[model samples]
Target chain A: MNAQFKKGVLDLCVLAQLAKGDKYGYELTETISQEMTVATGTLYLLLRRLNEEGYFETYLVETPGGPARKYYRLTPKGLAYTQSLKDEWITFIDQVNRLIR
Target chain B: MNAQFKKGVLDLCVLAQLAKGDKYGYELTETISQEMTVATGTLYLLLRRLNEEGYFETYLVETPGGPARKYYRLTPKGLAYTQSLKDEWITFIDQVNRLIR
Candidate 1:
């Protein structure tokens, strides 16, 4: 995948994943990495950035006999942002597919 | 559409268009603008950046009784880059569709 191209949509992908439910850094990375190549370091940075931007809020959850994990959840702002990105992506692919096909 | 998402894919879109043949700035913008929102200024900047990156080369075409139009064509490097981007896009979309749907 083009690095530049991935840079464009990675945020939306991560946000969409979080919108489904809270996820730890590793879980989020694993889910998206299943669909595409993504660096765990890069994802962590994005999570931090989104948190600072108020799109996500993180909380630590304790698990029995395991370390507490920081899970990410979308804020109202994050949900709204994700919805807009999804709309844009759908419209974009629709147009591109029409043209290319 | 999400500006960032568009930013990721617009270069690939433009490169794909050029790989088909040469195109003027207006023509390129008009072709892509049909499918997505892009600022003329932004496209121009992208053109310049791609050119500098050796992904595109420009030439002036003399049109009868009109100003010379600047047309863009893909260099060998540009062609290779476009092919790679196309492959990545196809895979990315395929994965994303599966995940999102």
Candidate 2:
């Protein structure tokens, strides 16, 4: 796969996943990596970018079974952004589908 | 749409379009902008980035009816990169589709 293209959408996918609930970096990375092969380093870099962009806010939260994890949660802006991305992706894919067909 | 997300995919889309044939910056921007709203500045920046990355090479081509235009053509590396992107996108979308369904 094109690592760069995968890397490009990684941020949006991470934001979309966090829209459901707060998740720590490792958990998020694991979840996405399960669906698509992604390196921990790439995921971490994207998480940092999202945090820096103010799309996500992070805090240390203790888990019952383990040490405190840095949980990432989406802000209102992030949710809105995700919705827009979904819409655009649908439209873009629809067009591409027609062209290919 | 999420401007940043749109911005992220714009580069790939531009490269894909150029895979069909060589096109000048304005023509490429116009072609993509027909399907997706993109600013001229943004398209130029992407073109410049692709050129800098050596994925594309540009040269001036004269048309019978108009002034010479700068045409952008993809290198072999660019085609291979585009193929990789397409494969990754297919896999990623398939996963997302299954999840949504």
Candidate 3:
């Protein structure tokens, strides 16, 4: 896996994970990392950036005998953006598939 | 399309194009731009970078009543690399499709 390729789609992966439901940082990281080669640092930075950009909102929930866990919920804008990215990615890959195969 | 996404796959696209036959910079750029949002500047920069990285070799071809056009041909390394990228892309997209849909 290329480093740039991982960086390119990491945001989309995070958004797609949240699209399923609100998830805390560790859950999101573990889910995506399981499927791809993503660094914890890169995932956290993307989360912070998207958070600052208003694509996601965070809420803290208390856990038993543990610190509060902050979960990320996708905003309306995030949902729309994810849809667009998904559409583009599908189209792009389809075109490449035709060309390469 | 996201700019970073474009940046990430541009190399694969160019190498795939050259895998078919040799092409000058403008021809490659036009072909890819028809399907996606890629700037001329970015395409040229990518070409230069790949050339410097030894994935591509360039040669000048004379055009009748015009200046010579520099065409790009894929190196053995480029072919192998393109194959790897293609494999990774297919696998990654398949995983994402399963998760998202």
Candidate 4:
């Protein structure tokens, strides 16, 4: 798969995963990486950006013998953003499908 | 639409447009822009890059009373590139759809 293309949809994938349920940074990485190629560096950067943008809120959960895990939960705004990105994906793909066909 | 996202697919879109037939630079841009947002600057740059990568060939077609228009036609390589991009698009979208669903 094209890396740029994959990067383009990573945001959507991350948001969608969070939509399923909140997950810690590594957990989110694990879920998305399972489906496709994810540059962990890019994923973490995206997570921070999304959280900064108010699309997500993060909470730290501490483990007994380890550092706290930062979990991401989609805020209402993030849900709305995800829907918008999904809609754009649909419309964009539809046009490409028609052209390629 | 996210500019980066749209950009990621623009190479595919441009090649798909030429797959039908040849087109001049502005002509190709117009055809794609009609359906979705296309940054002309980006499209031209993509055109040049794809051509350099051997995905397209260009020729000048003189007009009756205007400057010659450079047209783009798909080469064998361009056709193959288009197919690969189409395949990538399909696979990428499938993953995204499944995730977002």
Q: Determine the iRMS, in angstroms, of model 1.
A: 6.0
lDDT, model 1, position B56: 74
Clashes of each: 0, 0, 0, 0
Of the candidates shown, which would achieve the greatest TM-score relative to the real structure?
4
B1-101, model 4: which lDDT tens digit per residue?
A: 22233246777778888889999988987887677666678778988888888987789999999889999989898898788777777777777787778
Every model's TM-score: 0.76, 0.61, 0.85, 0.89
Error of 4 at A100 (Å): 1.8
DockQ of 2: 0.11
What is residue B53's positional error in candidate 4, in angstroms? 1.0
Question: What are the chain B TM-scores of all models?
Answer: 0.85, 0.81, 0.87, 0.88
- What docking grade does candidate 4 earn? acceptable
Model 2 regions lying over 4 Å from their true place? A1-26, A37-64, A68-85, A95-101, B1-8, B63-67, B95-101
* Clash tally for model 3: 0
Tens-digit per-residue lDDT, B1-101, candidate 1: 22233346777778888888999998988998777667899789989999999987789998998788899989999999888877767777877766555
TM-score of predicted chain A against the true chain A, for each candidate? 0.84, 0.83, 0.86, 0.86
The CAPRI-style docking tier of model 2 reads: incorrect
The candidate that wins on DockQ is: 4
Query: How big is the positional error of residue B97 in model 1, measured in Å on the Cα after superposition?
Result: 2.8
Give the per-residue lDDT of model 3 (tens digit) for A32-93: 76666566887788899999999999999999987999999999999998888777667767
Model 2 has an lDDT value of: 0.71
